[model samples]
Target chain A: MAHIHLGEGSFPLWALVLWTLLGVGLISAVVYRVRKGGIKTHQIALAGIAAAASFAIFQLNIPVWGGIHMNLTGLVGILAGPLLGALIALVVNIFSAALGHGAVGLLGANTLVNASEAIVAYYAFKTLIGMDWDVFPASASAATLGLSAGAFLMGAIIVVSGVNGSALPRGDLTIAVAGLVGLNLFAAFLAAGYWGFTVTGGAMPWAKRSAKALQRGVQEGGGALVELGRGIVVAGPIRKGGLMVEFGALVLVLGVLGIGLYVYVDRYGGFEDGERPAR
Target chain B: MTVTTLSNHVPDPRLVTAFAEQRDGPLHRVNPWTKIGIVGALVLAVTVFDRLALLAGLYGAVLVVYGLAGLPYRRLAGWYTLPLLFIVSVAGPLTFLEPGTPIGGTLPTPLGELSVTWAGIVLFAELSCRSLTVVTFALTASMTTKYTDVAYMLGRLLPRPIDQIALLTYRFTFVMLETLEDLVKAALSRGANFSEFWSNKRLYARILGMTMLSAIEQSERLVKSMEARGYNGDITLYGDVSRPPIHELFVVIGSYVAVVGYAAVAVYGVRQ
Candidate 1:
């Protein structure tokens, strides 16, 4: 779910051009970096996995109040690295918008945000991992940081991009944009929470513990109730050509497949997971 | 084993299949990149949406485009509804939240004073319509064109490695989806209920966690299968991506020209 849905005419022609150029430029750089590294065999497989995972993870919905979704750019970045992550973000953005997962017009801006998130998160996670931090802590911090940056990037696009005068007066548009920024932050926080828990809380003892907590939640009328209620309200429409369910479900599935494909692609080249590359 | 039974429950992967195809509509006949250019040019022209009449006209144009494409309204309704909701959520709140020409009267609340403004409501309508305009244009291009065509277009447009990434992403995306389906089925077989999974977040997470672990393990196994099949770094599309037929190309170009003419008039002549 897109936090900010900037409609048409929000940004001027030059601004849209600028953003597209910026996005294209960044993607080119990432691609250049990938090729220059002389990765011939398993690296391509890893990149594919990275793209698949990024797209899939971006589709998971937490169903929190009014429903929030996690893009998992941070996690994808960590798994796939910067070059692949950047390309993946652009592809996922195209798929999401086309498939009706996010706003279509905002694809360029959103791609920029995703690219930035992947790059930022990749570096941050790698730095932490290099410092010998545990995977859990590194993932959490990177996720929070990446997603927070993403939230603000969305805000910046919302603020600077479109024409507000046509809607309300300039003053009111400013306040509306500001409110959207706040909304983005809040949504990002919830998504980050979902992600942090998924990796850290999903492990053996933690998984068992979390499952109990979830059971209690289901029984106690918490987020579980929210999902059930949302499902009831939306499921009927969802079945009748609603791409939301299809999107979220497929993306997650693709994510799993991406990882599996990556493993396969790598192994096909006689590369082991542990021996992947120094990244 | 319950595995056989559980597999029966997996929903048909329709959305992907739906997207991977090109419908035989007037619009679908155009090469994806040309339509993409048309969509892009229109999206860039969104600045003219400042006027209500122009905004409505653009929307009407999208409806006409849909009609010309021979696409079904019911098939596209779901896409339309989301932007409507987005408008309400985003623009609706502006009426009460932003200070402007009040509609009726102000209300006193614990949070503070709240007034639904005329200008704010209008602004919401305007912005929401604007969002609708761009979304519709993008959706039309996406719905009418094939995903493979778009990816190939992207590959041709972008530099080398990026093109490779685009192609690989397309190929691997389906593989990943199939893998995910199997995982979900396996999860379902092992005492996980679909209704219960949806109802409970933590349990879903627990299952997701298992999937995540399996994802790591599966990657390893997949490499073996891929290696056996002679895996390489390159991705190959099965067939050549066709260009738009001349008539379709002309139609798309003519539309883009009209859009540009309208936008130019709106931005320079009328607005000035």
Candidate 2:
């Protein structure tokens, strides 16, 4: 459910081809892995439900907090594993493009972005739960990490897209777009943090606990360092984005700081009317 | 074939499909593949040209073709206004925000001298026009061609399971959307209505969960029904229609000439 506001001609053809090729390769690998069991009827059915569910939830931008809306990208990963999650993400992007929500040219790019989030969330949640972290924190952080990666990639694309069509290299627009992405990334972090606690706060029957020895180690000392190490590893990387991508991160972080206020981009970014207006 | 479309409100399901089933003319008469080629060439031409005048010229030419096809201007406006605004959101600020060598006038800002670069002004127009042209071209293609037919053509281009997955996804999205609309109504009726985003977060999650559960149940039923009908798990979403008998050579040559010539102008003559 990663909705980028990018349109046709936003990207240079080479970038479009490169990202698109990478996206197709990933989906192909997933498809090949699943097909090893044959096109088992049940697997397809399960994939269908996953795609349907994500599509439905994505369409209805549920008003959740501060007039903001949500589509349950994180929950999709938790319920469905990496392969089906990516499949659902691709389907969601297809529908979105047909409905004029995003550019068809960006189909491959958008799919990769959503798949990244789903994959990140799935592995992150599993690892966090294994470590006996509270379900809320684990799931939310997992979700946040997925979405943050998406934001970064999207920002980088927007920045590089200027080279494709603009005459003088519109660096100011690039900065604004990058700044907007940064703000969205920050929002993802906050939302995941808050959503995690709210969902798993007291205790759920399903929530598991860490082994007593592991719990005791956490209570002793140096537990934070171990957790921090895990966080760094789980952050992961899709591919080496090189220097231009690093510059995108610089724009996002530095722009947010230089503004010295809540970036106003939230007001004008994404699908302007993503949440289905009450009918 | 039925198709899924995104909109906030319901309309005739067929209308939701991007093509007009009844209209017959130059646009509709043109083959879907040619339309795809034209769009690809035109978008590429715009991308490499980097010329505002050339972009504007291409955009006007596209509109004239749509006009010749009798597409209502109101419909064009309805579909493309937000996308146009989104393009502005990216390119609009460059009208004033860019800093470079002064073209004419300069203003002192907190940071330093703020001057409107000739480059920035041209960049803004080029990008805005490029974005509009590409978006309009996309809408025009969808409006004039049956997407299922295009998918069938694509089915021939891609591998087997990928095509199967694509058609299946398209078919099921509508199924899911109906289920979703019904669920939202039921939720509201039961006073589980969403008010604030945060407080009702759990309610939202519950709705999403329920939707997925229902989709799974629906999928099981659908599979059973499909199996009963002797469905062999092939990607057969489209039905047979005779291919149009028109020769495609002219379309190929004309499109190449237009797109290539346009691009050549940018390569050989464009200053920016």
Candidate 3:
């Protein structure tokens, strides 16, 4: 039972240190690339803003699939690219650690896991963006595959840490390995699905288009506010009423679904051990 | 539960005093690598052994070393209690030793028939002590050694190529942090207020895109400065100062004695 339960509980300090060095090196090299790109100062300023906002995005821990929730640091990596994005994620995770989300010791492994996802997402998007395939299919497929890559790497790190010739039994090590695979992959898939749906807004070229349209709608709404401030005769109350009506309907639908979920979970699936009730 | 001295706004005076005393302390006179080597051996001795009483003895020996090093008990206790409460509340509940499925006590149902036998309590206590022992020693090392010294030691132990990268990463960490702070302040001043940015997706996108561009640009500038100064994939660092022979010998001999003492206590306790 201890073999299954504890399953290779020790970590090699040297291995952890070495991995941290490698992870930090990868981030530093990325920083070097960003410096060499010779972008305009304002653009550089913009990038900093983007990175900080992305850091906030990583902290926004929304519930997703599979009964597991984690910060979307990996997605930020994809959007920011390997170098700058990874650096930001490293900073964010460090702050998160100080808040007790995870240990300072696991920083290297966590950074690598999230950074790989980001790198993979960037390349995947670039590869499939203008390809002659259906945009949704390509985006969804890329996202799904990228998520699996993150999960596999996280699992592999755990397995590697458990290896100690002659000291730990093979069976015990395997149990630990399996446990990591189950936990990480389960969380990864749910996160990938949520990101693909809400953030991507339907996937591929279409996802990009939807996001752009939403952005335009928001821009138009801002323009309306400005127009009202100028006291000029603009789009009448009817158009404003119509927009509000549409928004109200959408909110109403989501509110109903959320309440439904609350009721269902309350009736069945008694909250798991160690889980705090929704406040 | 509130024992977080390291991050506390009002730092402990004893910690400050102990740290100040360490400026002219014995450990400072010892070679960094020697301290590291002894730390490594002690880490292995603690981790590879799972015996509870053994871990407690290890903890005892560590307390004595800290006492000798002039580390205040209040400071140590402050740092140690949080992880201790965490282990008891979480790991303790999970470590239910199945001693013949001991009679289900009259504990409430939501607590889930917690059939904790004597063995379970003992195991949890041991594991918690073991973790605290290693953690305290780590804190001691961190409290004493400067980060640069650790990086320098790594530079000595590792090949020149690998060590160079380590040095660069360590040096630039603070610089990047400052850049991040400045960027965040700039954003707040430039109308990307938190509530508006979050509620409006377009504003959020603009904010995100802008931040990314700036971070990339900042990174590029940093790299260029490094390159201009003849930084070509390798980092060069300064030399290490000589340590007194007596201090080095104490670290070496004291570490051995501590490990042996821990083992003896463990063996005796287990036999009983």
Candidate 4:
């Protein structure tokens, strides 16, 4: 879900070397451990199949978030364990890059992003299961956390590497990346919350009812606004229609406030075109 | 779902394998190692040089090589969509934010003035060239190199169990893809609505979860079959990769030397 789609030379040479070295170091450690421990034949089979599954799914575009793809690295971690899971991340990224889905030069950075997802998911799931959580909740929570960690790491990499031609300063880039990560975390949690809700068969009926009421109220308010626009105001107490008017006013005020804030920043914020501001 | 929508822009692994096996092109005959070495050199060249002219030249040469390999230019163009999108998303803002000789007069907005800069456009072009060069060559290599050769290379290049896993993964990826396609078909047949993601998130999750479960079951069967065939932990790849011919080796070495020389000159300016 969180993949760096940057091109070759997107990062400076030093960043490229640093990320590649770190990626290689991690893979080396994993390989050394695998060789020493001597993996069972079944485990080997699982890893291969898991890699195949991950690679296949990586290419798929689910009709979510305007056709986004899911990594399922968390599931790979849970099933294949961390060691093989990390290896699977590398294999998947390599195959993906070869097919032009990701940049070959950024393979090292991408592998780290994905491998961390798998490793974190594996440990999180284990800990949750150890704490006597159910499979559905444990897996869901772990996967969410894993994806959030990957998103955060991806943002960190981008900010640290810094886009070669971007005009934004490091501080500004960090803020932008932080906002992106926060949005990703929100989406992850939303999906997990929905999953939990459905799996538990409407565990929070009151919350569901509240959502339905809000939706209904919004719809009714929209209808009332159209009526008012047509000069056919109903002679009744304020209801859903009034709620709609209030919501519209709130949105208008917020929009104005946002514009005001932007103007303030433009005038007061010490930034110049492609140049860092005086601290 | 239509096949186009099901697969999107992803290159069919089966088609890639078929091309490698069936195409009797000059590229197919060339050693995979030589192609890989040249790709490495191209990557380095793109990384070290930021000049638009040099990057453009490299891109043109790569396209020529791709064409000479008898690969389909139409498909190559189609594959450019993702890389181009990436470049645009990253470089688009720079056109306004970068300080330079604006191509057009700046437009005054409430917040600030926005202008497209020559430097920004050059940066965008440079990135596109760098990205597409590697992407085109990679596709060419994968399409030309046989699966067995790729497996052998993986075996030789990667460590013990990882190599074995990669080999098996490569072989089974097609199988898993077919399985997924079937699953999608079944779901669509049952009146599944995939267009509205928020409304059908559960359905999407179920389909993916089913694919995972299918993979686990398939792996169990695979393990049993391997055990029956007297399989040990190691899965050896059949056939050995031939070395690049001597002349090709020289070209590869020369490319490396040229890249190194260029990098040295770029980093430490040449003295008179």
Best by lDDT: 4
Ordered by lDDT, highest first, the candidates read: 4, 2, 1, 3
Candidate 3 per-residue lDDT, tens place, A183-217, comes to 55554554455434444444233345433432322
Kindly state the fnat score of candidate 4.
0.59
Candidates, DockQ: 0.17, 0.21, 0.04, 0.25
Report the CAPRI category for model 1. incorrect
Interface RMSD per candidate (angstroms): 10.8, 8.2, 11.6, 7.3
lDDT by residue (B1-272, candidate 4, tens digit) is: 12333555567677777778888888999999998899889878888775778889988998898888888888777667667766765666655565568896989999688788887777778778888889888888999999899888988888877787888889899888888888778888999876787677666666666667677778789989999988887775679988999999999999999987886676334555
TM-score of each: 0.72, 0.72, 0.51, 0.81
Collision pairs in model 4: none
lDDT of 3 by residue, B1-272 (tens): 12212133222322442473445555454565565556555555654455666667877987787676655677566555445543543334334422323445735577355466554555456556655665565555545665557556656754333344334434443344344345445665886554432244333333333333444445457566656777554456666634536867686778777666654464223233
lDDT of 3 at B136: 63
TM-score sort, best first: 4, 1, 2, 3
Q: Give candidate 3 misplaced runs (Cα > 4 Å).
A: A1-279, B1-30, B63-93, B97-114, B182-215, B241-250, B253-272
**Chain B TM-score for candidate 1:** 0.72
Q: Which tens-of-lDDT digit does each residue in A129-194 have in candidate 2?
A: 778886557767888887887778777766654444333344655766776687668778767656
Best DockQ among the predictions, by candidate number: 4
Residue B246 error, candidate 3, Å: 5.2
Error of 4 at B50 (Å): 1.3
Residue lDDT tens for model 1, B1-272: 01121111111123534643735777676677577667666665555445666667777787788778765565566445555665665566665765456777789999788898766666666666666666666666766667667666766765666566666656655655556556566766787655432356555555445444444444456567667777665455554567767876787788778767775675434454
